[model samples]
Target chain A: MLVQFYNVSKVYPKGKALDDISLKIDRGEFVFLMGPSGAGKSTIIKMMFREEEPTRGQIFIAERSLVRMKRSDVPRVRRGMGIVFQDFKLLERKTVYENVAFAMEVVSAPHREIKARVPEVLRMVGLEDKENSFPGELSGGEQQRVGIARALANQPLLLIADEPTGNLDIDTSLEILDLLIDINRKGTTIIMATHDRELVKAARKRVILLDKGKVAADYAPGEYLVC
Target chain B: MLKNIWYFCREAVKSMARNHLLSLATISTVAICILILGMAVLATLNASHLITRLESDLEIMSYLDKDLTADQASEVKQALEAIPGVESVRFVSREEALQYLQDSFGEDRYNLEETMGKNPLPDGYEIKALDPHQVPVIAQQVEQVAGIERVNYGKEMVNNLFLATKWVRVLSMAFIVLLSLGAIFLIATTIRLAIFSRRKEIYLMKLIGSTDWFVRWPFFIEGILLGTAGSLIAILLLAVGYETLIGSIQSVPFVPVLSNRALLIEVYAGLVMVGALLGVLGTYISLNRFLDV
Candidate 1:
């Protein structure tokens, strides 16, 4: 298992956000956290990245216990995973090439490695031709591709994307899904949280449905749609 | 680390340029604060210097017995010099004392000599203490010496000067400390506003696995740059104003102001260091709120 949650719970001032949730994701699996708003899908994703600590219970990512991890060690763990956002957060002033290279720069990668890898990652996202274009000039789909490319620059073991296609049209959403599926095929575990029921059904991946901060269903590929 | 610093500097410059108006405001505020602080420091320095000059000039005048022989008077001088706190003792003969009075009379010296047929001035030994605070004690010791008639050292005036300067030093020190705190708070608030403007950028940096330090380095550099620039302006202004004031007062007598080039350089260096320190502190306080993620 690449990720494990042992009876984890998260409590806020108002109420419990995640109540005694437990699940496991193996390496190279494409898992969809399908739920409506306030389903704790985002909360679980946040815990996996150590953005929020579990109020109770333990979480282990890559066999390292996140509950016991030091605050200073968060960056090192985060570098091992990529994160994509719905709004496609990219520095508007930077070109497509610089945007992707920023991830490596933040880690202080060697100049030679940054020079060689940035173009490679941009090409992987099929944005090699738009390497010099600014985010403001790019279309919405192209911008998200840049976001994915930047995330992949570190060559993470897992990719956690929250609502990656929440703002896209149906056709563009499917295009992004195909790209995600292609990346997963190349041996990267992906856990995406989204409310787009049709998109999840189309991906044909393992689905973990959450409702009211608890796991509602755990179904294998092609099985979730049947239920 | 060197590479990271370089990147941080570049980003800091970029951010500064992006918010040129805000940057200018912060720099000017720093400059004004430092300028006021520098003036206060210079004032206190000058006040203390003047007091020290006056204290050094303070001396006890020990009158010799009118009938004492030259040998006995010389013995009193030797005894005064032997005192632990005595720097030196100069024996002034009655003739020299009379001549000093004559010189003071200027054109009327002949009239003063004609009015008093014989020189009745008593000879005195001028005693200078090593420490100004020991002047009274040294005067008392001088009076106890044989052949010494009386000792006078302007006791009340010296005590008043010391008391006044003590208050001046205390008040200035308190003022400087309060001003420093005010400056730090101002810089912190300004930097906080600047950081607040780019909160989204900081959030994204945190999301992308940048360490808190990594995200903070740029803002730190920006703050330091602002502080340095502000202090430089203040130093420039202070140097010019001080130099001009010194020029205007050059012909004036008895007013001791700081004019040592080395000392002025040291003060400027101190201001720069203080400015940079404030910058770092302000950046740290401002960045603390945003880096929790």
Candidate 2:
């Protein structure tokens, strides 16, 4: 298993976000987590990156339990994973190239590697010509594409995206989804959280329907039972 | 590692450029604080030097017995010189003593010579002690020497100089420490504002798996640069101001300040060290509060 949530539960002062949730994702699998706003999809994504720890039980990535890991070791674990946010958190001050290059720079990647790989990743995202354009000048779709390219810069094995297409129109949403699916097909395990039922039904991959804080249903391709 | 430090330095320069006004404010505040502190220190140093000169100038004048011959007076001078704390002993004859009186009397030299037919001034030995504090003990020993009448040194003058310089030193030291702390607080506030403006960058760095140290290095470098720059400015101002002060007060012989070459190097070096120390300390405080990963 590349990722595991073993009876993990998160309880805040207000209420429980995830109540005894247990799931496993295999290597190179594309999984969709579907639910309403309060269904703990984001919490699961946060736990995978060790951003929020489980209030009870444990989580592991590549068989290493993150609960017992030292705080200093969190960065190393996170480096092996890429994350994308719902609102397309691209730095407004940075150009598309700088936005993507920032991830590599933070890890102290060599200048030559950064100079070479940034353009390649921009090309992969089909924004090669827009490398110098700042995020403020780009459309919503283009900004999200820059966000994806930045996430992919480090070549992480696991890509956890929270509502990746939440802010786009139907056409743009499909385009972004197709890009994610293509990236997933190229041997990256992708777990995306979304509330768009139509997109979920169309993708038809391994769908884990989260209701209230627990996994309400789990189905494979061609076996999804939409609510 | 060298490349990483170079990156950090570059980032620090970039950050300072981004927040130019705040950086300037911090540097100016630090410079002003150090300037006041340096001035206080210099004042204390000059006061202390003057007091030391006054103390060293203290000497005991030992008058000889009236019936003592010239040979006996020379023997007394040699005996006083042999004492442990005695620096030197010079025997002044009656004629030389009269000439000293005449020189001090200036225009009244003839009137004094006519009024006093005989030279009543006694032959005495002027005794200088190695340690000014040991003057009383040396004076007592000189008075007990054979053919010596009495030993005289200005006790009250030495006591007043010690008391006055002691207070000056204590007050100036307290003022310097307080001002330094105030300067550090202002420095930290300036860095804190810089940090506040770029908090999003910090958050992004942490989210993207940058180590705590990687995110902190730039800010650390910024703090150091601010501190060192402020100290350099303060030192320059102090050097110019002190030279001017010494120039204008050249006629005041009693001041007895240290020469420019000596005091300048010492004060400049001390200010630089203090500025750097405060910079590091201010950075530590700010980072400790905001840079938690």
lDDT of every model, 2 decimals? 0.91, 0.86
| Residue A152 local lDDT, model 2 | 92
Clashing pairs in 2: none
| Per-residue alpha-carbon lDDT of candidate 1 for residues B57-146, written as tens digits (9 for 90 to 100) | 999988989999878877877888888999988888888988888888786637665788888889899888899999988888888999
Candidate 2 lDDT, A118-167, residue by residue in tens: 99889888999998999999988988999899889999999988998999
Q: TM-scores, in order shown?
A: 0.95, 0.86
Instruction: Give the local distance difference test score of model 1.
Output: 0.91
Q: What's the DockQ for every one of the candidates? A: 0.67, 0.54
The candidate maximizing TM-score is 1
Off by over 4 Å in 1: B98-120
How close to the true structure is residue B144 of candidate 2, measured as C-alpha lDDT?
A: 83
lDDT of 2: 0.86
Worst 10 residues of 1 chain A by lDDT: A218-227
Off by more than 4 A, model 2: A7-21, A53-56, A208-224, B60-86, B92-153
